[model samples]
Target: MALSPEDKEEYDEQRFAWIGADTVLATKDSDQIDKHLRIIQARVRTKSATAHRAFAISGRAGLGKSTTALTLGKKHERQRRKLLGDGPEVTPVVYAVVPPGATPKMLMRAFATWLDMQVPQRLDAPSITDQVVRVLAQQKTTLVILDEVHNLRTTRSAGAEAASQLKVFTERVDAAFVYCGIDLLTSDLFTGDIGKQVRARTKMYALEPYALGSARDREEWLELVLGMEDLLPLANHPEGSLEDEAAYLYHRTGGSIGSLRGLLGDAAIEAILTGKERVDRALMDDIILDEEAVRHAQESTAPSPTHSRAKKTG
Candidate 1:
């Protein structure tokens, strides 16, 4: 039976709401991060007093480093709740982001804010740090995730202080530390003596963008596209709409999951609004993506000068 126009409009609104929310797809990189997080959690639990090892996930922007870390942290929090029972104060995961141009006090305040602790403005950096450390210890927070850690530059005075303070947090609190940031290994965060200390303790996991240079790569890319397509809410969409344009999609997105999400999400919304109820090459071509993805796609597709010369000779 055909529904009323009003009913169809209401249903479309619900679908839009669903499409707006982020959908986390489990990938090989996230799986590795999860395994490492579990190991760190176990070690921290067994040896509470010892300063345990930490890990960092470094990558270019739009490679889903923050998303991967946050998702793992949330998963760990859920597991802890199951084991320890969900108490108001049983926070097994504390997630915070390093503020831009963050000072030591500012960084501590970020943690304090996440833990819902209100520190008076009169308090000094040491006082704020002490308070945050105390609460983290008391709450038995087992995982501390600091995203955008690349912002804590060791070259500048304030950033250096914040980086040192972070080290202190790892020592003072008995939680497994995980840092996520853009291009951290080459950044000033790992350059000095302090950097040596950090580098020695934390393992680095670099998340590279997906490529289409191999058969396996193509297979994985297709699987990812299929997974994303499965989540679309279009009623009249074909099953393999996205898969049919796999190569074109890769050229458009440069295999960055975040960029792909942006492109598909916008296209999906456009499809619903325009009553197309399906995504295809034409619709995606009309959707503009981020500057970086577009630049990358252009670079990837452009013929090399060597190829051009060879074509002329031939």
Candidate 2:
């Protein structure tokens, strides 16, 4: 059924609109996500007479670490619920972000809040810790994830204290613990006496960023870009439309998954709004040009000696 010119134009517009607001694609990071899920699932399934062992996953920002953690956590939680089959809301997987400058008391309060339990105002750290354990047990939470754990206070005595509190939490709860943060290997949470104990019990996984200099990385990155191009809404789609711009995209995004998505997302929105059938290098270049201008403006206004000296001489 060949369409008339008007019908083809309308269809292209509709396709553009559909791609404009598409959900985030995580196919590029599936391997990392799968590995993390496997570790969590194994621990969650294991029978434990006492406290379960903990695990740590570390990755830099914009690497989809949190997204991977939350996505897998929710998926397993759903599976656990399905297995129970209306017996109860067995929260087999729980995810929470660690509060900035988190103390033992603050951590407990956050945990309690996540579990829908009341935060006691007058309770000390130990008391709150007990309450959190009880609530987690009652909810049948089998895997607990504490993200951004690097933000927890971990200096001098505070570091040891926080570690001690964490040890206590893991010991008291039967659920396995998973900590997500950046640079965990170098973090204070993995040093000192208590840190040594944590290091001994936990398995560590580090997510590496895509490096443009590596042949394998370039190949993987190109695959990701092409995958995104496939999802772009367009009429009269040309094969390898975005292949040529692969290097440019990598340079612009520093080979980060999050940055690539941002570039593609903006391009898709512009394509829809302008009623264009496809995205091209020119559109993405304009976006990057505008961003560079904004960054330059910010730098120009910053307190630098050259600028300050010029103003004074003027």
Candidate 3:
């Protein structure tokens, strides 16, 4: 049986494995990160209640850009919660991974649930916006993290309507959002109305493929890439160290942290299931070349790729 969309997402989170993409993103993509952080710092420091702070974060696929934003959101809120309190004064950090072909109502529904607010039964575009804005005002959220933003584009209106919705949502609210997407020209090459709006509010970060770097940086990055515990099974291999695998792993994932985690995790399990306890370089190679790995993965559990989008149930 095909998994529900919600079930597919849950399964993906549980099975994820590699670290190549995240390592480079956290360590190598310094310039991009600096800019993203700067924007966040600016927003949080705004003194005026009426002044709004908003910006966009765009990176190439396979970079840890989204993860980085999510991390920032998570950490910032944690610190804020400690400094403030657990009550309504705390700035709620909300996250949403926008879906491909998603309408504005769909996006709004996601934000509503993210904030633990009521999801309206009829999620029309206007209602979605009204309800979400009301909830954000009620919860006092200061930061919103939108991951996989490239997926937010839909076949309808070529994303014009959706873009307008986001623009309206971002403009009137005091809250800030860190929007994550693929590299600027390659993935988003933002066109027409949507392009202009994204360009206006976003601080673009172009995350490129990973390259070999300093020894300490590479080691730390690799450990972060594949968690120490995650790499324990590979210790018995004669031909490998986790650090050695990092470079090749980076190439396979094209520097996308999310994909890197999923790819590596998938390879490790495949090796163990095939009677090989050690995840040597070769097994990683098989997974590296296997484009099918990703497809097979989504196929195993996710809903059949839905070209026909479903409207959210009330």
Best by TM-score: 1
| Candidate 3 residue 256 C-alpha distance from true site, Å | 4.5
For candidate 3, the per-residue lDDT at 314 reads 10
lDDT of each candidate versus the true structure? 0.84, 0.70, 0.60
> Where in model 3 is the C-alpha error above 4 Å?
1-27, 30-35, 44-53, 86-91, 152-158, 185-189, 213-240, 247-259, 271-278, 286-314
Expressed as tens digits, the lDDT of each residue in 216-247 for candidate 2 is 77888888788778777655447678898887
Using Cα atoms with residue i matched to residue i, what is each candidate's TM-score against the true structure? 0.88, 0.69, 0.68
- How well does candidate 3 score on lDDT at residue 236? 41
Worst 10 residues of 1 by lDDT: 305-314
Greater TM-score among 1 and 2 belongs to 1
* Model 1 misplaced stretches (Cα beyond 4 Å): 1-22, 48-50, 307-314
TM-score between model 3 and native: 0.68
For residues 203-284, could you state the per-residue lDDT of candidate 1 as single tens digits?
A: 8999998888999999888988888888888867899878778888888888888888888888999998888878888998
